[model samples]
Target: GYIVTHVDRATKYLMAQKIESKTAEAFNKATLSMFMPLAPSKRLTLTLDNGKEFSLFNKIENRLKIDIYFADPYCSWQRGTNENTNGLIRRYFPKKTDFSTITDNELQKVVHKINSRPRKSLDYQTPKEAFSLENMSGALGT
Candidate 1:
């Protein structure tokens, strides 16, 4: 499974999705699905690390019509937001744990817990509160 975060630059609202995949193809599909529900203006750009796992960026960009950028090798600071979130996730699933044992339902629960937790950057607002469908629609003037 992969964790994808979509940040709306204008409002600083973020939508995060946990996607389950068995292969690179499935990963790309899951990534696209996560972005499909958002407003076009909010889906401006995607920045990902140069991991082999993200080699399918072409598919994601083509399907979503969003630009994709890659961070330089060894430049983890460039993707600090995502790197920090990944660290938070590691608290739940450590690096050595076999992800193959995790079920889809269990994965959703993990995603739920992460989203519901308060974020200091968001002034103690949980991501669920800050980036709810209702809030996004309102922010977009929909």
Candidate 2:
């Protein structure tokens, strides 16, 4: 399985889904499903990897009513929030963890745990708290 991870820049909120494949179609479906419930806001934007699997990004932008940008090659730091959140995820499932063997419920538990913690970036508010308080803005200085 492949892991698709998303982190809210404003709140450090995390959402992840495991897919059977890493194709563009799989990525698109997982992305839409994870975000559909919140529908978050039009202010949402994504900083993503330069991967062919994200070829359907334009479709996601249209459905979610948001913008998307690709990080520069070899510059993982460009997506700092995402990188940090990935580290947090690593705390639970270290490098080379067999994602295919991990169940979705087990993964959601990690996501829930990460979002419930307080962060200094959000002034000590939990990511879940800050996410609800966002009012559809201010993730990337909006």
Which numbered prediction scores highest in TM-score against the true structure? Answer: 2
* Model 1 / residue 80 / CA error / Å: 0.9
| Tens-digit per-residue lDDT, 60-137, candidate 1 | 888877888988999989777666666766788899866667776766677678778887777787767767754546
| TM accuracy, model 2 | 0.89
Measured by lDDT, the strongest candidate is 2
Over the stretch 1-142, how does candidate 2's per-residue lDDT look in tens digits?
8899988776677889999998999999999987777645434678789998999999998987778899999999999889988899999999999899999999999999999999888899999898877745534321
Cα lDDT, all candidates: 0.67, 0.84
Q: Once superposed on the true structure, which residue ranges of model 2 sit more than 4 Å away at CA?
A: 40-43, 136-142
What is the lDDT for 96 in model 2? 94
* Pairs of colliding residues, candidate 1: none
Model 2 residue 47 CA deviation in Å: 1.3
